[model samples]
Target: MTLDQFEARAREFLESRCSRRGPVATEWGSGEERLALFHETTDEQERAEAEAALAWQRERWAAGFGWITGPVEHGGAGLSAEHDRRYREIEAEFDVPDMAPLRIGLGTVSHALLAAGTPEQIATHAVPLHRGEAVACQLFSEPEAGSDLAGVRTRGVRDGDTWRVDGQKVWTSNATFADIGLALIRTDPDAPKHRGLSMFLVPMNTPGIEVRPLRQMTGGASFCEVFLSDVRLDDALRLGEPGSGWKVATSALAGERRAVGDRSHEMNARAMALLATLAQRTGRADDPAVRDAWVSLHSRLQIARFQQQRMQATDERTLTGAERAIDKVLLAANYKLIGDLAAELLGPAFVADTGEWGTFNWNRWLMGSMGYRIAGGTEEILKTMLAERVLGLPREPQEMKR
Candidate 1:
């Protein structure tokens, strides 16, 4: 289809389903403060949200808007990347499903499948994920390996005709209701750490797999710890050849780094808007100190938004390591700055039991902001990566073995 034809089709579909959000001005200290970086929802709430997201995605898939850039064989539109970009721009103006529920499935898992999954695997798994028949979550981080992803200890012992997976995965989002997990497990303990690993599209409902929600300081369980014990999965579920997982894993991680930053722009904007309103409501808007900090945080957020946009505008194939790391670091920095400014504006309101509109509500945000610094990729790890990979600095000395 021509560019104009695709744009027309998307606009027509969105107009029928949802109204346009032309200019939404925030009411001072009112409306849903919804300033959460990590969402906390009960099991029931999560199921409802996931269902809504899935229904919308399925509708879109039926309408030919789902998986706009994915290949036809994998149930995508088989269109150019530019077409996918255009579809997003058109969809942004309209009110639609939250889309958060399917983010990993489509953005990271599906992309990894395209890179490493066999054609049959893509048809059976990735296609359905985009079709909203299933939801997928990343099960890469483990208790022992968060930043050092290769140090994972999740083991998948080969048995005749199947593999038995046994290990624990921590900090997994959407594991509670996800249909599948793109899990990385060690298949060869004797090989070098990175070379021993393999990736799998593990069915979450397997008999021996368990997902336990983790309560965070924010008083909500936004993530989960998953345990697999003797859970047997078909060999067909393997994402790539044994020992090729490192390559497959990097493809997924790179997609994740790019999408995380791009997706955070709106959340940060809502937070900054709330911060500005809090200053006004508390009569600190005129204070020069508050004003300076607010402007600084706003400036930082704006720069981060631009960085995210620029990164998004660039072809994924061309993004350098430095380019991808910048947005994540900037985003974390802004989260911290936003929290600090909110605290300054909120005085005793920070911990007050009395429910003030914009006051105590920021408590949740503050907690998430601090935790986010270490989530995704830690600022420390991303910095070291930039130093060594992009700037050609000498590597950090590895500790000598005992």
Candidate 2:
């Protein structure tokens, strides 16, 4: 269908299902921004949000709007990415449940599965994930292997038709409630570090797998430290050919970076609005320094948005690893810029947790913004990749083995 037709249908569907809401109004100190870094919610609140998101997703999927870009066999509409983008634009007009929690599953994990998983694996996981029937998390980072994903020490040994996995994964987002995890494991210690890794689709409920929530400074326990001890997995759960995990991982990481970058524009808009409100409230709207900061941030945010558009225009199937790193770097930098501006605007109120509604509560966004710098890929690592691969710079010398 044409864009107009699709948008009209989407509008009709959304209006029929949910009430339309106006653009968020500025509430000065009484209202919080929509771009939340960490949600400090009770278990009941979290569960209710999750349930609402799932129900909304199911309804959208039943209407053939859930996974617009997914294959028809996988319960999607088999539409173009532009169609998906338009649907999201139309969706923004309604007051729907928050669906941010589904990003890791629907964007990162699902993309990885489509790239490297077998037909059965895709059919089993991707469809449910798209329908919001199942949630998935990435179990890639470890205590010793943050940016250096190839150095992961999680081990998996094959035993006939099963693989026994044992190791610990830190900074595992959404693991506390995930139904499955796409884990990277070391299967060949004798080989090179990057060559010995493999990926697995492990059921989170499998025996010997434990998840412990890690509280963050943002007052949220959204991340977790996962321990897998003698976790037995059938060989059918393997994601790709043995020892070919780096390929699968790089694909997923690229998707993660793209996803992070994709939302940078929206995030920047919200942050800019919040900053403007703060300046007005503090009577600093006329300050030259504040104006300069706001202008600089707006320019940088536009750059980030342009970068996202460029990345999207490129065929993801053909995007090189280095090219994909650009979005991540831009996103992290934009987030840091927003946090810094907020700090400047709020001054002392930025650091302390006053009982005020929007003033001190911004600490969550600042802390979370700092974490984004290190989340998908660290700034230093991504810059290194860009310099070496994209800029024709000489590679950093590898340390000689003792």
Candidate 3:
């Protein structure tokens, strides 16, 4: 179908489920506007939002618009990526619930499953995730293995049909409410660090699983530390062949980097727009330094956009690991740059939570900026990848012996 036809169908589908709303106009100095980097929702509020989003997704899935670019056998439309992009364009104009909470499920976990899951596993999990009947989280990062994912020490010992898992994962987003977790565990400790790992689809409600929220500087407990103590999983839950988890994790990490990069561009644009409005509100729009900063930010945004388009156009099979790392590096740096400019614009107000709404709220963006740098991959790690892999530089030497 043509783009217009697809959009019309999407519009019709969305209108049937939710009210049609035009793009929200940004009003200068409106304290009611949301400018937080991370949502500071209470547990009740987060649950409500997640439920509403899931319902909307299920409705969309029922109408054949949930997974536009997903494979046909997996309850998706099996259309081109452009078709999916068009649907998103149409979605933005509606007053539907935000789908941020479902990103890891749909973007990362689903991709990982598709790459390495068995046919039965795919049939079981894909539809539920696409329909938003279930949510998933990544259990890759650990306390000692944040950037060095290959160094994870989570262990899973095989016992007949089940594996007893015991490990701790930190910075696990959505664990508090996830139905399933895509976990990496050391199944073959005798093998090399990278090769001994394996991936599994673990039920979050398993008896030995525990989730503890970690409150951030932005006053949001969106990140959590997950403890798996003797969590038992049937061998059927394993995603890929034993010792093949590194490959599965690489695929998921690629998806994660792309998702993070896309979100960074979007959030950076919104934050910059808000900064422009703040300048106008404070009568600093025409100031030379402000104009320079605006121009610089716009230039950087354009560069980031170009990089994003390049990444999107390249087929996933043909894209190199360094190329994947570049998008995230640009994205994280761009977000930090935008946050710095906002601080320069607001001065003291950026730091203090004054009675002002939009002004003080920028603290959310600034505080949350650091987390983005570390989320997909740390700046230092990505830079090293670019250097060694992309630029043909030698790998950094291991740290000197203590």
State the C-alpha lDDT per candidate: 0.85, 0.83, 0.84
CA lDDT of 92 in candidate 1?
82
lDDT of 2 by residue, 230-332 (tens): 9999999999999999999998988788767665665567678878888888889999998998888788778777777776666666778776688778777
lDDT of 3 by residue, 260-327 (tens): 77656556666777888888878889999989988987998898889888877666778766787888
Q: Could you tell me the TM-score of candidate 1?
A: 0.95
TM-score to true structure, per model: 0.95, 0.94, 0.94
- Tell me how many clashing residue pairs each candidate has: 0, 0, 0
Taking all chains together, the TM-score of candidate 3 against the true structure is 0.94
Task: Arrange candidates by TM-score, descending.
Answer: 1, 2, 3
| lDDT (C-alpha) at residue 222 in model 1 | 80
lDDT per residue, candidate 1, 1-402, as tens digits? 998999999999999999898655566645776756787778789888899999999989999988888888666898877788788878889878788888889888998999899889999999998898999999999998988989999999999879999999999989999999999999999998889999999988989999999998878898999999999989999999998788888888777776777667667777777777777788988999988887787788878877777766777677655787887788788888888888888888787847666678778778888777777677888899988998899999998978
Winner on lDDT between 1 and 2 is 1
Ranking by lDDT: 1, 3, 2
